[model samples]
Target: MTSTTERPEVEPARGGTHASGEPADDLLARHRAVAPSWTSLYYEEPLELVSGSGNRVTDSRGRTYLDFFGGILTNMVGYDLPALREAVTKQISRGVVHTSTLYLLRSQVELAEKIARLSKIPDAKVFLTSSGTEANEAALLLAMTYRRSNQVLALRNSYHGRSFATVGITGNRSWSASSFSPLQTTYLQGGYRFRSSFRGMDDDAYVDACVADLRELLAVATAGDVACLIAEPVQGVGGFAVPPDRLLGAYKEVLDETGTLFISDEVQTGWGRTGETFFGIEASGVVPDMLTFAKGLAGGYAIGGVVARGDVMDCLDANGISTFGGNPVATVAANAVLDHVLDHDLQHNAARLGALLKDGLGAAAQRLDLVAEVRGKGLMIGLELVGADGYAPHPAAAAAVLEQARAGGLLIGKGGLHGNVIRIAPPLTLTEDEAREGLGVLLTALEAVDAAQG
Candidate 1:
């Protein structure tokens, strides 16, 4: 007799058909009718996820996948945990679901305190927002205003967010939606080197070269009239491109000399997902003057936040308020997430399991030439697919692997400028057996695609 949570991947006990019982094609058609054309979705036949438990999610068609992507690294604690559900339900029962930021909310204040303490910035001040875009928007405002410059510097192959402001700073053209940017953005080299002139150089040498380039670019491009240098320690949407250790530190040295600010966008890489440290940027030994977070921080609640040096955050003279920034329910959930992460020491789990998963993928990449590189720290891993020629990006291989993994009951994600890097960041609560199972499915899918392509 198996437990209720236990279900075969082929035959989920519940959630087989859409609530409306509409055909899958009709459902997609209905979505297309209401949604914008540019809204990206996964798969040839997009999966309609209905319910989840632990690391597995059941689709509308009664199939359960070992969810490796964790809802784009948002579901850090996984789905349908009793502890999480009960806490949220109790909060909802207390009547104040959303009281905005007008009044002092205990949950919100508690969350702020935790984040401030965790944030490396001294005398930190935090502002909550509804999403990463909003959090980053807040950071940008602080930096530009504090420095009184609209000019910003970001790394090539980096993604901040989707807003007009962040899109201006975003260097990835694929994720950049609009041409009109509010900031005069100067793109730098160094984060992604899959096709970089800095390729093949040793790590320290590469960092030195990139720092030198940044100095030259600043001298020539903006002449050091920049407000800040915003970067992700591990380039998340740009395919988990882990810059060499101290890369940002090297950049910070340059920024500090010019009184420029540094902002770390840890939306995907924060909250111990990077394993070795509390934040992904920690591995770089660079404490950003401003830090932005979202995605997995609030246990899947809609929340984003920015932490800044108190003086910088308070520099703005105008009165400002994010109406629904730290809603009560979301803050409660965020508090629970923090407690769980700290109590269980999931950071160590991430490091241990991340090493196991990366070892497996690295071995697969070594054996199968289809995979060009297996890079990333902790659980935020990426497997970059390539053509038979080895360097050319093979997005088709990535696509095939995604579909193949889905059919084989595993859900992974793909990113990168060319969309050729498979992103794998599962929940921090992922079990060892579960990690191995997902890894097996992923390797099989990779091998299947490699053989089919050959």
Candidate 2:
């Protein structure tokens, strides 16, 4: 294992000049000049990651860190897996990368079939897209067309995607840039339990309260012709918030009565990231009308899609095509990733390593008062930081911890409505030793932050 102490402290370049003639500062300045202002970045001095192998990534400054964030949980099987590389290489050799949806690609058909088999939705059919946002957009379109209503329900503190339509359903104000959307969205309150109105209630009571609230919300907020209730089984960018197991099942019961669809946004929680099951919604014991997936499915390849019942999927009368959706390269890569995940049983690995990581994080939280909670399932875990009051969010502390952790050779992530949660979602292939190493670094960082505040 590489130690941060051994790494050289190369001073950041000013303007467009650096010792190696590749100035990160200049690149960042150019990025800022062109990219949207709302684009968030991590660290006091943001890193320019150059290369990665397995669970470790090296920065432009030649500093190596154990990548617990997994490129925001997109590197599901880990970086640069031999099998994935070989599959992509073979596809590249074929000299056909993009075939749009107009052509019938063998890889695309095989992948769609594989996804349908794994989706758990009966008579499942899939529509591929380029990202999670597009997948959610497609699912929304299907729901609206099938139910013939624009009214939709979403959980509070939820993040669906960044597209115009998805932003409307996204309950987090920080992520949702605008209220201008065609869909009439009503936010529900059960997806997050920590800062909920039913915070003091037991699990059963919490589920019941949320269910009752949903029923009341539908009665008062909607015209009884609701389209769908889109939700993340384990809220991702909303700080890995896992609602009660029965929450979605209860919501589904209400939706069933109203002929409303249930669309599970499994972009983050899919492909065994949640452990014990292939999809996070399985824990809720509900098979959704539509399931959207992205991120880890293609092992870093850009691919997203929606799996729905045959009738629901075929609801759209107008012809549509995704220019890069289910392209030869991405589909082949996705198929390879799925095969590798199943062959090695990474889901079981996620379950085992997740338990170890959660225990380590819980122990660290016990020693640090700033850590308000450590929650999540499988490889997707979050540590929420609090202020001296012990309950109020402490974004500064979280930031400090993040910086310190990076300096100590660990790369994690941050999320939450208040940006006070440390998100630790390593690849499902994370070993016990790596988990312990990461936990030790995180604990040290937390201690440092606590001491600095004192």
lDDT of each: 0.90, 0.90
Per-residue lDDT for 121-207 in model 1, tens only? 999999999999999999999998999999999999999988889999999989998989989999887578888888998888899
Residue 91 lDDT (model 1): 99
**Model 2, range 91-160, lDDT digits (tens) per residue?**
9998988989998899999999999999889999999999999999999999999989999999999998
Q: How many backbone clashes does candidate 1 have?
A: 0
Q: Residue 240 of model 2: what lDDT?
A: 95
> lDDT, candidate 1, residue 447?
94
Taking all chains together, each candidate's TM-score versus the true structure is: 0.95, 0.95
Candidate 1: RMSD over Cα atoms? 7.1
